[model samples]
Target chain A: MKFGVLRFPGSCDDVDALLAARRVGDAELLWHGERDLKGADAIVVPGGFSYGDYLRAGSIARFSPVMESVIAFAGDGGLVLGICNGFQVLCEAKLLPGALLPNSNLRFTFRQVELEVVQEQTAFTCACGLDGPSPVVLSIPAKHSWGRYYADEQTLADMEGRGQVLLRYAPGHNFNGSSNDIAGVSNERGNVFGLMPHPEHAVDELTGSKDGLCIFASMCLAVEAARV
Target chain B: MKARVLIRPKAGILDPQGEAVQRALPALGFEGVANVHVGRMVELTVEDASQIEPMCQKLLANPLVEDYEIVLDT
Candidate 1:
């Protein structure tokens, strides 16, 4: 599988994502201005302060020229993963439901966080062993000022009914005051996934945790599963 | 035409910045402060007045968690 990691101006984690992708499969760096995805089977929108987080995080990056192709790629059923600011961008682009609000503490939170795999049936979490004995917990780093997931009651209800909520902060560890402790969510089709934590940052053993590799591995499995 | 847009978090959506400011006001000796909701103001030069709403809907504000008001400057 080929992974395209998007690089936008002010994006801080593009390199990290590229390295993470390289560890799993062939990876390429995609520019924000390019209208093509370079035939990537899956795309990863890496974490960063895209557009310097001006006018709200991910708001400006959503309008980048490459996003047009990203939208089309997703519409064609290609897998897409958005991490940190990428999650904000996906929400702004309307590829995913709900919005990420400022943290309730009004401070930038940067630390390793525990995430519970709420739904592992999706392409992004299938490697977490959904049918296992207990919930799969990942030690991933979440670094952001606006990471609180929010949505209206009806929309939240629909998301819950559809199994769209993919991950939540483990019980009693909700750091950002996200509603329902939502740490990540998937699009209705489950092909698109967005999460606040930086999975790429946690993929290396040198980073003290390799738990995030499962997320990328899950994408590889999804791609192989689709080919069957 | 010039338009001024005010975008704010919707009611019931948490506004941590505003809450922080509200808490600081009393400590700073300001009294009678009930609540504070911080919002953003955007100024735009547009060709048509009618385009303002669409701009708000498309980019200026996310209707899911924010509400935007547009005022045209004559």
Candidate 2:
């Protein structure tokens, strides 16, 4: 499967994402504002200070020309994954369900975070299927001043009821003060996934952990599943 | 026409950046600063004021976590 990693002006993790995608399979980096999705089977928006986080985390980046194509690509059933800053962009663009606010601590927390796979049906989490309800142990670094995720009670309930809550910080251990401890979520279709953790950072054991491989691999499967 | 857009986080949502600014107010020599709220200021030149709504909806503010006000400068 061909993977397209977006490279915005200030995107810090574009290379990391490219490397991770390369490890998983064939991949290429697509510069932001290029006005095209390049026919990528799947697209990954990596984390970074796109537009220097001027207006908000992802607020400014959403207007980039690349997003227009990304939106169209996602609308046509192409798999899309947004990590950290990318998550913020997806929310800003209304491609995903909720918004990411400041972490409750109001501080940037960077460490090995544990994420529970709330729903494995999304193309993003199809690989990590642990038996029963135990949360999956994946080590990924997150660095953002506004990483808190928020949604109204009713909307939150609906997302949960519909199995759209794709991932969350481990129970009782949410690093960022996200409502419902949600770490990630997908739309009703489950084709688009957004999460706060940096899955690209975890794809290689040389950098840190290798638990993120499943997520990228899962996206490939998700694309193929949609085709079938 | 010139317009100013004020974007603030929605009520009940946490604002860590605002909190940081609030904490620094006293250190900056403001004793009466009991509260500090932060928002964005975007200046735009539009042909007609009607474009403000769509601009705010599309880029200025996220309806899910923030509310925005557009003021036209006469």
Candidate 3:
């Protein structure tokens, strides 16, 4: 599988995503201005202070040229993952529902966090074998001021009914005051996934945890499964 | 024309910054602060009045989380 990681101006984690993608599949850095997806099987929008977080995080980056292709790719059921600032971009782009708000503490939060797999059947979490008995907990890093997720009550209920909530801060550890403790969510079609934590940053032993590799591995498995 | 745009988090949404300020006010000897909410303002020189709403909808405010008003400076 080939992965295209988008690089918008001021994007900080694109390289980390590229490194993570390289470990799982063929990875390429895709510039924001590029109109095409470069034949990539999956697209990853990495984190960063895109557009210097002006006019709200991910708001300006949503209008980048490459996003047009990303939107089209998602519309075609292609796998798309947006991490951290990328999550904001996805919400701003309307590919994902809800909006990211400032942390309830009124401060930037950065640390290792445990995320519970709420919806394991999706392409992004299948590697955890969620259908098996035990719950899957990922040790990943969450970093950002605007990581609290918010949606209207009805939308939240609908997402719950449809199994769109993909990840949440582990019980009693909801650090950012996210509504429903939502750390990640996928679109109704399950083709697009967005998360506040940095999975790419945890894909290696040197980072003290390889828990994040399962997410990338899950995508690889999904791609292979689709090929059959 | 000069246009001023005010963007605020929706009423029902949590405003941590505003809450922080409200909490700090009592310590600073201010009393009877019923409620506090924070918002941002942007002043722009626009060529046309028609562009203001689109600007608010597209960039200045996220309709999902914010409400924005555009006022022209006469």
Which CAPRI tier for candidate 1? Answer: high
After superposing candidate 1, which stretches have Cα over 4 Å from the reference?
A130-133
Clashes of each: 0, 0, 0
lDDT of 2 at B64: 78
Better of 2 and 3 by lDDT: 3
TM-scores of all predicted structures? 0.96, 0.89, 0.97
Candidate 3: deviation at residue A152, Å? 0.5
- The sequence of per-residue lDDT tens digits that candidate 3 reaches over residues B1-74 is 99899988899898888888999999999999966889999999988989999888888899999988889999
TM-score of every candidate's chain A:
0.97, 0.94, 0.97
**Residue A150 lDDT (model 2):** 86
Chain B TM-score for all candidates, comma-separated: 0.94, 0.86, 0.93
The per-prediction i-RMS, to one decimal, reads 1.0, 2.0, 0.7
The local lDDT score (0 to 100) that residue A159 gets in candidate 2 is 93
For model 1, state the Cα shift of residue A19 in Å.
Answer: 1.0
**TM-score for the first chain of model 3?**
0.97
Candidate 1 chain A minimal-lDDT segment of 10 residues: A127-136
Candidate 1, residues A123-228, lDDT tens digits: the string is 9999877445567899898888899999888988999999999999997667889888899999999999999998898887888898888899899989989999
Candidate with the larger TM-score of 1 and 3? 3
lDDT, model 3, position B22: 91
Error of 3 at B54 (Å): 1.8
Local accuracy of candidate 2 as per-residue lDDT tens digits, A1-228 = 889999888899999899888887788888887977777899998899899988678888887899999998889878889989999889888899888877788677888887878777667887777443445666677777777788899999999999998877876658788888888888888778898888888887788788877799888777777679
